[model samples]
Target: MLEQSTRSERGSMTGEEARRAVREGRLSCQTSSLAPGYVQGNLVVLPQDIAGDFLRFCQRNPKPCPIIGMTEPGDPHIPDLGVDLDLRTDLPGYRVWRDGELVEEPGDLLSHWRDDLVGFVIGCSFSFEEALLADGLEVRNVAEGVNVSMFRTSIPCAPAGPFAGPVVVTMRPFSPADAIRAIQITSRFPSVHGAPIHIGQPEQIGIRDLSKPDYGDPVAIRDGELPVFWACGVTPQAVIAAARPPFAITHAPGAMLVTDLKNSRLSIL
Candidate 1:
């Protein structure tokens, strides 16, 4: 569990400062509340042999796999994202997958790096959560100091090559009025998942219970609050698992890559 004190301290960090802390092993917690105004991303590393196919998968399903930054095979630096970014040691945590099975969750990928590896950074809801919070909408997970609840849905993502799976979603609860405001606020940031995909019905998306989520922590829904679901970056990990790629690496849920890009820059409006 992340200490609320830690969250509060890191919450005010600049994107570069946060990444440096992660790189230096000073911090290894979820990026959810860290680097407040910057874009935090989902990391996906794959061998060049499968990178093209995965790229197509992201293209086919933009809502869940919006590409914010990508690196050439074997190259660790995406200069556009940060002047001194080092993919091998940047993210708070990473899950290694082999044959679609998660084998290990490592803090860094130094031993796992290879000449054939390619890196991708997908936009995460953390970006738009900043927008919603700025608009005074309560974000339960953030307020409760836990990961946003995420679930696998009956809805399917458009398949591309070997990547195909259920569309994964992150959930937040709000009153009807705030839900509408959240919709309007989030719509401005399409790259980070623009709007709620499903509202008021968990069973419709194959989610049996709001108390039990497939990923992240579950938060309480007060009376009169409705659960809202949005496409999540975890969809790529789900696809990677289903496809059983020979090898893959992705950020652990909520433990994202804090990039230098500001969240406001990703807003469409």
Candidate 2:
């Protein structure tokens, strides 16, 4: 386990060290602002039968669903994410959906593991958040200790089999200058949700109200800041829920899987 003796040590660990702690059940909580420069992922587990279709959906809709890494059916580890990574147990919390409705919320998904289950890791906002912070921009969600605000948008994702629905997005309010910097910084990391899909007007993306988010926490939007929207990994979960597959699993929002890969490694340039 990574010692939490001091904040510095906890903050200094390589991305893999942090994942090891999560896999051992030593840390099962929000990963926000942790593993400062490493990639953090949103996980989706599905039966082998439908995994191929889901992959196609992701391929067609890369913005909301970039595939960072995936595991073979029934396999728990994604060597690319971390040698110690176990899809069934590494994430802090999981949502078990049966026939498209959330039925159980578990800290880990060990018991639900099936012989035909496959795990897909979607790039998350956390990856880009690291990039923003590195450039000295304050990430409001981290500063406020809240999950990034997410919403079901008017944008429709490319349909693949049963995986088709309106796209969902996460919001972060920023000044014009900072928002531009965020775009530039995040653009360099396409694996972690590349860049903002929309900016300024929430209603422009079918988000009628900024104060009421469909998922996660609502942050204060002060004067002069625009709500920048990024295609969110949660879009898959929402689609799965509406499609109502017999069984599906997703990492609980904000409670993500920290991978061994550094956020810097995700940069395109």
Candidate 3:
């Protein structure tokens, strides 16, 4: 367990340290702005039988469902992502679903673990945020201490078997000029949802209100700032729910699996 005195330094914690705190029950909160430079992932666990279709679904929708790492059937660790990363407890939170209905949000998956389950770690947009901040752009959620605003959009993802749903997106308000720069900056991290899919008007993408986001918290938009949308990793949560698999588990939105991999490693340029 992390010492109580180290709590204030959580923002600077290494990926392994952060995971240690989370696994030890010392921390339980949305992990946005934590462990900067480490790649964070959205978690999805499913029965081994249906893992193939879900993998194809990710392949078909690379922007929102990029595969960063995965575990073998019944395995709880992803060595490439983190040497000691445990799917059962590294994340701050977990969402358990059954028959398309959310059953519980647990702190750990110890009770739900099964011998036939498979885990997938999807790349998170939060990983590319370091590049945005390094370039001097304000990441509203980080600045405001909140999870990035996410919403379901009208844009449909290419379906693969039972996995299919409208694309979910994360929004950040920025000036017209900054939006373009954000696009250029984010375009380098293709594995972590590269580039904005839409800018300015949210309604064109089926988002009716900026204040009321479907997942995570909404940030304030400035006078000249426009709402920029990026395809989000949370899309799989929606897809899994709509598919109504008998059993499935995902990281709670905003609560991600912090991995040992660095953000710089994912950059194409």
Candidate 4:
């Protein structure tokens, strides 16, 4: 867990500053609280051969795979996201997968860059967190200095080519009133996974244990609070694994690419 005192400092950091810290090896932890108003994104890199299919997959399932930015074949920079955003190194951590299995968890992707790779930056729920906070609702993972809990659900995504898999969701416990407010607040930010897909009853979504999440860390669910679920950007990792792509790369759960785009810019209102 991170010190609560640094929360303010992290919130004050610019996207570039946070990315620089990750690149310089100064910060390599869950980025839920850093660059508070900036758009943080989940990273997915695939070979040019399969990139088209993956793009269609994202288009088919916009809720969990909303595309915020994308890179040309073999390119590392996304000019719209950040002037100096290097997809190869901006994120704090990365997962390397081969034949549908995780093979490495590296801090940087310097050695893995290839001419055939294409990068995709998927909109993350973190971008809407600021709105939630501004509305006076607590974002538990940020308060506890832990990654938000994520689970694989029985709900299936609309498949595109080989990218078929179950929907993945992030859980945040909230009072019934706050949950409704949260839904209203997040609905304006559709690019960052708009609203809750499930309000309560974890088993209805096939989540057997709230304490044991499929990805990320579980947080306390206090009395009178309902476990609200939102579509997660981590859905791609699960899709990639099921598709058995020969090679793929993704941001580690909770560690995302901090973009220059502000979270407010994503709101429709």
**On TM-score, who's better, 2 or 4?**
2
Clashing pairs in 2: 100-244
Structural similarity to truth (TM-score) of each candidate: 0.92, 0.92, 0.92, 0.90
Candidate 2 residues lying further than 4 Å off, grouped into runs, are 1-9
For candidate 3, the lDDT comes to: 0.90
Stretches of candidate 1 off by over 4 Å are 1-9
Q: lDDT of all the models against the reference?
A: 0.89, 0.85, 0.90, 0.90
lDDT of 3 by residue, 1-269 (tens): 33452546777888998899889887777776678889999899999999999999999999999999999999999999888999999998899998988899998999899999999999988778889999999999989988889999999999999999999999999999999999999999999999989998899999999999999898999999999999998898789888999999999867899999999989999
RMSD of 3: 2.0
Model 1, CA-based lDDT? 0.89
| Per-residue accuracy of model 4 over 93-199 as CA lDDT, tens digit each | 89999998899999899999999999999998877888998888998987887888999999999999899999999999998999999999999999999988898
Measured with C-alpha atoms, the lDDT of residue 116 in candidate 4 is: 94
- Arranged by lDDT with the best first, the candidates are 3, 4, 1, 2
Model 4, position 194, has a per-residue lDDT of 92
Give model 3's clash tally: 0
Write candidate 2's Cα lDDT for 74-174 as tens digits: 99889978887888777778999999888999977778998899999888877778778778998888789888899999999999999899999999999
Q: What lDDT tens digits, residue by residue, belong to model 1 across residues 193-244? A: 8888899988998999899999989999999999999999989988888889
